[model samples]
Target: MGEDIGLWGVPLAIIGGAIRVSTPFLFVSLGECLTERSGRINLGLEGTLVFGAMSAYAIAYETGSPWLGVLAAMIAGTIFGLLHGWICSLPKVNDIAIGIALMLFGMGLAFFFGKSFIQPVAPDLPAISFGFWSDYPQVQAALKVNILFLIGIAASLGLWWMLRNTKIGLRIRVVGDSTDAARAMGLRPNVVKLLSTAAGGAFAGVGGAYLSLYYPGSWNEGISSGQGLMAVALVIFARWNPIYCFWAALLFGGAGALGPALQSVGVTQGYYLFYAAPYVLTLVVMIFTSSAAKTMTGAPAELSITK
Candidate 1:
């Protein structure tokens, strides 16, 4: 009985760690969900996220308001998205290649701008307390949840509802399913994809903002460790569903924290391997969820990757 109880503690700790660390991934994955649902992919979201983080940190340091930093990050993200969208809309420009280019550009821009602002002090976002009811200190610590996590959950629900129950959602799906069909229905496919990609970029940007302004509260080249790229993979695994993206992001987040968690428990032998857990899980999930045959059977027929 004692051994079983001790083993159960690990799962609970992982869940808590997941919630703590998964917020950035959740925002980015949800953003990718919207972009991919419109039959486009924005690999530049990696750049958007890093730049947003730097922008948020800089803005918050200057303004002394974390919320203001968040708003600035969104605006910056929108601009980045717009750039990607505009470039991709041009004929003879492959969106995938363009996305890669934008990503490199964005990363370079972030590192350049972030150099001068590395040590600036900024206001941090406040956490909402729900642990007052807990008697044990460990329980209270475990239950300390951030308001951003709640916001992420609410955003996921809202996105899911919009995609499933709105006319705009229908248009987006139609455009993704078949551009010819959308044209027949009098909808502009390019316009829809552009808007979706822009919106997704904004969301990803905000996710990046959260990292710099709230989680770490400083800027550096190592601020974002491929959360943006993993988020792209997460969208595929979630099948372009915002709600599923939330869960998948959380799972990845937990995987990310496993190394630190093990270190906390004094087990540091395979720390690097633990750090790779999220990527490994992502590859395995992608293989299982996105086989060529399965895609042919169920994916949106017009999706370029599937085709």
Candidate 2:
């Protein structure tokens, strides 16, 4: 197996893995970006993602439609978001603490309710096969792209455009930048944040949908592996730009693919090292972006860390 692939197979494996893995990261980061840009943070997203995964899988199993599962996940995520937003909007509640609590809550809900879903044969999301150009089975398989991947890319571009040119985008920016300014303009910061958080949670849910209905295509306790939490750091690394989030997601996805990619080419000696690529890259990004001298140059003034 190793000799058949040789050194050339590693890169191709990584590319294929990136396409598969980047979808979740892209959606999660975009969700976090939207919430953060509205001057709020929801660390509960990890739980949200897990719950979303469970919901999507269960619904798909029941309905025989992957798209319906996606919808269910988004709805589940919105409920989680509303809970987080409502609590955090109170006079003295800490968003981080609430987020942690919600994370645990979300996880608990998924675990308890999802027990029946384990091992069920759920409907899987369809992929777009670009593999027809290749005669080799490996090449053809590697080129199979999921429909959600393309949607994620388009969504990122749309987010960037909306944030730069729309009225609602302007409000989100202003509220995120300065609460007092928003209040002066007679806008309710809490209301805006509530909506943004819900929207963010929905996006995270969609990411979770990709996990179960598309990629690994299953429901289990250990499905996430911190992809949701990692996206928070990703938001910072991308400097909160939606377009940059897309590229950053692909990069992270590529890093995550390192170990599997090498293994595809029969190089398994350092498998764990390659698997650690994403975490290492995350730490490096945090270190570089952590300069106090910069005063968080691109950060919103009302952001939790900033305030």
Specify the highest-lDDT model's number: 2
Q: Which ranges of candidate 1 are over 4 A from the true structure? A: 1-9, 296-298
Tens-digit lDDT string for candidate 1 (213-245): 767557789888888988977888777888888
lDDT of 2 by residue, 68-147 (tens): 99999999999888889999999989988998999899889999999999867898999998989876666666788999
TM per candidate: 0.93, 0.97
Clashing residue pairs for model 2:
none
